[model samples]
Target chain A: MKKTVNQKAWFMVLPVLLLVAFSAVIPLMTVVNYSVQDTFGNNEFFWVGLEWFEEIIQSERMHDALIRQILFSSIILIIEIPLGIFIALHMPKKNSLWTSLCLVLIALPLLIPWNVVGTIWQIFSRIDIGLLGYSLDAIGVDYNYTQNAVDAWITIIIMDVWHWTSLVVLLCYAGLQSIPDAYYQAAKIDQASRWNTFRYIELPKMKGVLLIAILLRFMDSFMIYTEPFVVTGGGPGNATTFLSIDLVKMAIGQFDLGPAAAFSLIYFLVILLISWVFYTAMIHTDEENQS
Target chain B: MRISRSNWIMILYILFLMLPIYWLVNMSLKSNQEILDGFSLWPQAITFDNYMTIFTDSSWYMGYVNSIIYVVINTIISLTVALPAAYAFSRYRFMGDKHLFFWLLSNRMAPPAVFALPFFQLYSSVGLFDTHIAVALAHTLFNVPLAVWILEGFMRGVPKEIDETAYIDGYGFFRFFGKIFVPLIASGIGVTAFFCFMFSWVELLLSRTLTAVDAKSIAATMTRTVSASGVDWGVLAAAGVLTIIPGALVIYFVRNHIAKGFALGRV
Candidate 1:
């Protein structure tokens, strides 16, 4: 059906436009301001062009963080994507009661705040007070996030999986459910094998949602701060300090606004670039689906 | 014709997915003394002390209020603005319309860290720091875009004929939208609101950065507990468990839509 248009609809949208400009555009300009200038109280400012950016680019601190951030996000995507699809496939789609139960189980961790996830694990893994920690200790293994960097990293990563795999499961499940019965009937009549049925029919349909799940997981995992901060305090000697933790320390802990702001823009650009890539691919896939 | 090797792989995956969350509910039910004692397959003395603390304490209840207030505000602000903007984007192809939508999403792309200092500075400079409004506005930076995008999708799904049908019947655009468009996309609004609420509720970065003292959020307060004179494990666990209730309830109610055609609704 054809719909009529109204160009005057611009008036209806003016408020949101103005609000976004005020909320997003203006503060971003302030970040731009801090990135290039040195200020020594009383509103005094001195120009320092590209110095902060250059230092950030060369520093081992940033280099290490970039590697860790990339590794963490990559590891999560690799594990969660296929695993999420697997879980979605197993999920009961026909029964509403069972569907709700599965959803509740999957969403269990997403509701907990990052700090609480940290707290839960912090207590749950201690030999004295945490069940898993005590259990592992009883089995004659030394496990402590406070002392071992690898242990800390693993705990943080696992905690994130517990929290977010549900999202992927939910999205993948949605995609799987969209398959009409006709498709299955056709496959049955053709005597197609299960693998062939999924590869040709289900996988194609689920790709759109899988793409969104991957993108969302990437963005969220990249920006994750509160959990690691709470669990390790970016600690066991800076082993778990991602860019967000470093950015926070620089801005709040060290009062290094110029460098922090510059770092922030760099951080924003990295995420922006990655998301733009993912967003482009998702949209392209979406267009392909439509065609 | 048969359950393949892939089916076994799926069973293992679901079991892996369920374990940690199972561990949490298990941990929550254990008594503090039992938690400290040792690992057992089940809690030796299951107790309600943790859940009980949340119900009794004003602090825990206050967390609920603060989370609720800010979340509700953010949802309202997001929907109010995004609804009309989405209408514009779906109905009219204006100059920079594509850029505008991308710009909204680009706001989401920027890390909270990049904007943390500026948000704090901007809010403090205007004497709005540590207030609920600061958090609401900060959240809107991301939520508004999401709202617009999701709403636009839903609006697109509703063919434009409905708008014309109402318009030709002497209902102007405002009345048409008021009487027609909004009602049609009610579920879209609900889903968007659920997301807005979820994101705003679970968000710790900007919320912590923005508020202190009277407006200090639950997540911020929980972090402060580490430095408090003594650790109260039961109370902390209770608060943690309590915080999960709202989101759990939300997911439970919205689980049906979890598999619904949000492709046409998610922004």
Candidate 2:
């Protein structure tokens, strides 16, 4: 679709611009202000001039949290993307009763409040009462998220996979839905193997949605705070403390505003840079589809 | 009929998905004693006391009311602003349009943790703290961007000839939008609304930070269930179950469009 040159369109965009600026820009400026300045208890302030950024960059705590966050996000993307595509492949293709049922049930976790999702898992995985925990204990498998760091990591990771794999499946399923049956029929006539058919017919078709699923999952997992916070409270000795959890603790818990502000700016920049890469790639794909 | 390998896989995956939710529902039905006494696949002695407690307690139930209030307000604001912006992006080229669009999206990607303190101060200074509107307005940080992106995708699917045709038909801008263009993209609107409501309803950090009392979200309220006596397992489970209900209902209504919505309307 060709878009006309229209300067008047700014009026149409003004409401969103003002609303977002009020909601986004002002607070961002405050962060930038805090990042550059230091304050005493009575709000007396002095110029810091990147001292907080230097301190944060050198801090072992931030480094450890960054590593944990990247690892967590990588594990999430690894598990969810393939698992989602696999399940979507096996899903009933037709718009039958089963399709609707599957979609509704798959989407169930996504709609649950993030805290409630944590609560549900908390209830479901308690060794004393939770079925999973009790059953694991009964089977002589040592598992306790509240006690062990590895167990906490496993619990958080599995919880994320359970909570988010549905999103990937849904997106892939939609992409699969858009593929014309003629492609499949052609594959059948050519006597292509299932693997060949998937590689040649389905993979390319799902490229757009796959990029979207990856982008969303990556950003969400990178900034994850609520579910892990609720489930583990970033506990078992800071084992599950991702960047957001650490940032919140600094900003709100400890009132270390300067370092927290610097931490935030860096965190925001990292996400922005990565998302820009993904966004650009997606747009390039869209343009390719058009041409 | 014999079940195939794929059917087995689907069954196992769905069961995996349903297990925790089933546990939540099961816990919601059991008495606290039953929940603490032992683990049961299903509640051996079913009880409605937890649900009764939530229904009877103003503090408990008001959380839902507050959550719904902000979520609805946020949805309305997001859509009202996003509709025109999406139309502009889809229909015309303007100065800084691409940069503006990406900037909005970057907000969607911005960590709520980064904005939490600033938002608390910003809203508190404005004397809007603990109000439903505060949470609603605060949520627009991300929701507005998302709404614009989704609606833009949907609007792009509409042919430009329709706009030209409307102008030729003598329908004014607002008139054509309300009468012809809106109805044409009604499903798109529904899908965008669902995404907005879902995101707003599920978010916790910003909502919890912005509203301490009077407008506490159920997610935040659920935290108070941890008393000195330890967690109230039954009532907490019940509240969690209740939170899932509204989302379930919304999903049911938009089940058909959900796939496209999950794709953020690009599909």
Candidate 3:
């Protein structure tokens, strides 16, 4: 697909550019402005000149939030990527009533409002009323997300896995669907075992889609706010407070605009750098496929 | 005939997915007293008072109306801009095209928390605060990029020869795009719209920040259930159940294209 060098394409893209810039650029500039300046009540302002950045960099709370966020994201990627791929593999390969049914049922969790997801799990994990809690208590296992830090962590993680693993399955399923019969036929002719066939035939084909899946999961998990906020309220003494939650606590809860702004910039940079790495890898794989 | 290993695994996984939702629905059907008095796998006595409250109360039902309003506006705006931009990216290699595409994605990477305060201030200053359009416009920051990415992939799959053929047939550019090109890529449009609607519908942070009362989303409304009243479990569960209905309807219509959308569009 050779594309022509047409400068006129600029005209076509102008509308999107304007709309995005109006939405993205203006607010971004405001964040930058707040990051550099200090303000008191009644809108009085003073030149801060990196003081907020320095203070935030030195803050223990910021350090803890960053560590917790990174740990949460890594754990999610570790668990979800393999689980998603496994689920995708086990999914029925042919389109049937059963397959469509599974697809819809599996995707139901994703379409639920984030707050509702949090609320449902909050009720479902409550010791007094939640089935999980009541059952666990009946079995003599202690399970209370509100009271125990480890329990809260486990609940949030499982909730996330339950909420998001379907995305991975769907993406991998799509990747699997794109593989033509020729590849599997060749594998059968060679008398390949399941593991060997998967390794040599399916893995390479899914590389691009898998990368996209991993990146999407990473970014979404990294910025997760609403569900955790609703469920735990970042409680049990800030144990579950990730970066976004911490930023909100700072900006909206306490009105620490300057430090929150600085924190936001740093958070944005970290996501940007990682996403760029994944994006470049995806493009490289695509170009290799073409060549 | 016996079940295969794969069938069992899928059965278990689907059960896992449905358990929490089943729990929500179960709670929604129970009276708040029943919900709190004891733990029961099945409701001891079913009640629809929660649903009745939401339907009969203006504050509760208006939240749904507001959420739908902004989500619809955002979807339309995202698609309108993205269609042409996607065509440009797919059909021609213009200067800075690659850079531009990546820049749009970078906006997607920016955490909503980063923009919440600024969005609040910006919208407030422009007198757009508490309005449906504010949330709709702000959502495009992410949805537009995604819509463009998905639409561009679908458009590229259409052969370049179609444009040439349409031109030789004496069809003008806008006329041809509306009549011929759009119809060819209708599924792409469907997939893109679904993504936009899904993101806008579920998003809470910016929507919560940008609007106060007039356009407050249902997600924000649900948060108020947890205040001094000590969590109205039944009403909250009912609201949660109701929020899922629209999304379920959308997925039913787009079930066939969802997997393909993930593969072809940005995941």
Candidate 4:
């Protein structure tokens, strides 16, 4: 039987479509306009065909930044996905106060602005004035985010982990909680070991969430800016510059709009493609669960 | 239902989680001298100077005010748009409905960096550049998707029978929604608002790109120092610690609703 469809619901969607179109779609179209054109500094754009895209794709600078972005995002996904799940598995589900406390603590890093996270760690990791820096120095270990490329990479990765791991943990924990106690009871009666229960029951239940966490983390880490920017200024001499950093330097610092716009589109497509892959993976997992 | 060795693991986990926060609070209390002097678990002498900077410095506190204003505005606007959109997606199937839903989700996937240059140009053309609205509107790109995604979860959870019965009782669509659906999803709306607030609050790239002066965020303000002389590590730490308060206040109230909200939608 067909149900009576309310046509009025269309009104509800109008505001969102208009608002989003005005803000997102229009500006994006403008980017597309800039992407295919050459600007001559008088607010006049002449159609330049594929010259900018060709320049960007052939440039070593773009290639290097793309490699760095992929590497950073990949490392972030690997560490964050597993660490987040482990954390979610360990977090308390019972005690109300303890749950609240854990929630508050995990959320602390997320609340701080990205630049501040970089700043906090920058100060916290300084050899002379920073705590981590001085502590490492005192312990006979050398540490300098600004001087050593490896240290800079480690600091940036750790800073990101500290900042975003909670989001994954929160997502996974939420997924964990939604699985009814009946599943755990079944596992208990089957005499499944803790690892087996996690492998067979909890992991399946959490696959969807884990996919989303990975995708979100991958996209954000690939596009990360303020934290690394503040921490190393994309330096110790270009050791940690991600795609977004390079784009900003081109667009804002150097005022290279043509190259920057081209780079930005590539950056967007990479994120879109990666996210689509994850989304398809999630759908595949959901189908497997049904089967 | 029995306590086991897993409990021990939980205890260690809690401690690991609490330690960094403890360090942050510890540093906030210390003088710049103590922070620079050495790494200590406790501040040698506690002081309110860091907190004082937030109050006495107009430029610093303005970031707080601007962030709050823009975040609040964006959250409200996003929800207002999303509530209707989510309801439409949940309640009805119309022409292009599936296409619309995917479109909204795709917006959530697009990176903000790609749009930053275009947004700067678009807003400049419209005379909206470098203002609170510019950032708030830019933020709505993602926030609207988030709100709709979560709100769609809440709407789906509501039984269709509820709406049917309300209509039988002579309730019109808007009246039924106002009286029945809105209150039923009150917790959802609150949760969505909290998450939206969280994202908009912590976001730096779009916010930074959209504003430079008169409405610069603390995140952007902190970046400004990098181009200048020796970095102000102490003041920066103070500023960093202060940014956590609003989010803490939000999570304190809405933490319960958010877990379920996230799991149902993006997760």
- Per-residue lDDT for B187-216 in model 1, tens only? 888878877888888888899889887677
DockQ of 3: 0.78
DockQ of 1: 0.52
**Ranked candidates, highest DockQ first:** 2, 3, 4, 1
Highest lDDT: give the candidate number. Answer: 2
- What's the C-alpha lDDT at position A178 in model 4? 76
Candidate 2, residue A9: how far the Cα is off, in Å: 1.1
Interface RMSD of each: 2.9, 0.9, 1.3, 2.8
**Each model's TM-score, in the order given?**
0.93, 0.99, 0.98, 0.93
For model 2, the docking class works out as high
User: DockQ of candidates 1 onward, in order?
Assistant: 0.52, 0.87, 0.78, 0.56
Give the clashing pairs for model 1: B149-B267, B150-B267
Q: Which residue runs does candidate 4 get wrong by more than 4 Å?
A: A1-9, A283-291, B1-21, B37-39, B223-229, B265-267
Q: Could you give candidate 3's per-residue lDDT for residues A76-156 as a string of tens digits?
A: 899999999999999998889999998888888888888888888998998898989889989999888998999999999
Better of 2 and 4 by TM-score: 2
Global lDDT scores for all candidate models: 0.80, 0.94, 0.91, 0.80
Worst 10 residues of 1 chain B by lDDT: B258-267
